[model samples]
Target: MSTCVYVQLRCRPGTTYDVAEAITLKEIHSELYSTSGDFDLLMKLYIPTGEDVGKYINDHLLDVPDIERSLTTLTFKAF
Candidate 1:
């Protein structure tokens, strides 16, 4: 089955727009947007298998510039 991960991203101070643009350029995220609360951005990611989830996050999402922190949530059920 496919795996879905929801990521809460905190961007560096004064860099939200730049970070968002960078994320958009990558085009790896299923959805990405700015938001309030403890995070500046939220990202949805899909992978073909659960095993690739870790690598995908570490190699791709973590590589984005101006990203201060990230919280990843793995989906357990659709409904």
Candidate 2:
């Protein structure tokens, strides 16, 4: 089973596009979207079972340039 997570990204001013591009280059996210509100982007990630969620996010998403902050939400039971 995979661990599903939703991550909200807060990027530096005018850098949302750059952040999105960086994310695409990583090729780890299942889905990503631009949004309004406290966060600038919404991303859905699927972490392989036994993978460290925090570390995966850190290396794949948080480490990307232009990402100022991130909020991660874990999901259980779809439905």
True-vs-predicted CA distance for residue 26, candidate 2, Å:
0.8
Which tens-of-lDDT digit does each residue in 11-73 have in candidate 2? 999999999998999899999999999999999999989989999898767888888889999
TM-score of 2: 0.94
- Clash count, one per candidate: 0, 0
Inter-residue clash pairs, candidate 2 = none
TM-score of each: 0.88, 0.94
Model 1, global lDDT = 0.88
Please report how far candidate 1 places residue 72 from its true position, in Å.
0.2
lDDT of 1 by residue, 1-79 (tens): 7788899999989999998898889888899888999999999988766567878888887898889899999988858
lDDT scores in order: 0.88, 0.93
Clashing pairs in 1: none
